[model samples]
Target: MPPRRLLLRGVLTAALVAVVSPFVHVIDFFYRREAEGVKRQKIANMRDLTPGGFIYFSYPQTGDPKIDNDPFRQFVLIMTEDGQLRVYSRVCVHLWCLPSYIQTRRQLICPCHGSIYREEDGVAIEGPAAYQSYPTNALPMGKIEVDGNGDIWMVGVDGRIGYGREWHNIKPDELVRRV
Candidate 1:
């Protein structure tokens, strides 16, 4: 084989490898990270939510619209009949539609298909949805602690309100810096 032809072939091989290697690494990295866990968001306080009221907020970490595009939103606030705060993700497991808080029905109703979720525990109580409920994907229940000032903080992924402890414990001030 000619020296020039050999050199050209080597160069082409190196270029091809260089381009493909990064893509492969990126794909692998994303999958691996996802499998381990995804950091969705952090909330400063339960006071940010009103009793029987719900609000849509962004995670800010990935800049993915919390409730609009992705499967889940940053948080959902539902003040239970007992007056305790209930926070969870807004994503519906059936078809990813953002469920609305139906005060009359006393549950989160998916406007798309009428899938009803129990606001108390995010369990699917009624409707066409087959799944038990939508996962939290972040914000552990125990981490939702209130300081002496009555400010609350939430941390973790795939957790429910008032379930357990052990959260990422992100401070409100530090949260702003991270974002």
Candidate 2:
């Protein structure tokens, strides 16, 4: 190969690698992360949330939200149309961007790509998830059960915890039945 051509190829390869490296890290961070001390955190009471209501809390988050947004543990608890209380993953299936509830439309809209999801069903209605490129369009929800104390206890996650993994990680001390 000519000297000029070889230099150009080397430079292009280096530049391409630099551009793609950050994207690879971003995707890895989204798809996979340490479960980070999986615990059934008590965020709110059943009466605190109205029917067809939503609330945000970061489980596994000890830092101040004003300082940093911990993407992993941010979750949304949704009161369904039939009065079932469920805590669903706020991460969008397409890009893993945090979605917020749109009060007027009563839908969860992804700020990243305008992905719309039915807050009740956790099903993707529009945007990148409409075509269903990901494994499951429906967001993974953690099971919230009313314990003997009448407080909402997040029992286990729907997807990974219920699939093949056991709930052994939840220590006995981690569970506090206080409202």
TM-score of 2: 0.61
Q: Which stretches of candidate 2 lie over 4 Å from their true place?
A: 1-37, 62-68, 160-179
The sequence of per-residue lDDT tens digits that candidate 1 reaches over residues 52-162 is 665554332354354234544345555566656555556666666777778877777779887777766666666766343233222222223345655544443344322
- Number of the predicted model whose lDDT against the real structure is largest: 2
Which residue pairs show collisions in model 1?
Answer: 66-73, 137-158, 138-157, 138-158, 139-156
Residue-wise lDDT of candidate 2 within 39-119, one digit each (tens)?
A: 565667778777778788766455678422666566787776666666666777777788887756777898999888776
Clash tally, candidates in order: 5, 0
Candidate 1, superposed: residue stretches over 4 Å from native: 1-28, 31-50, 60-71, 130-143, 159-179
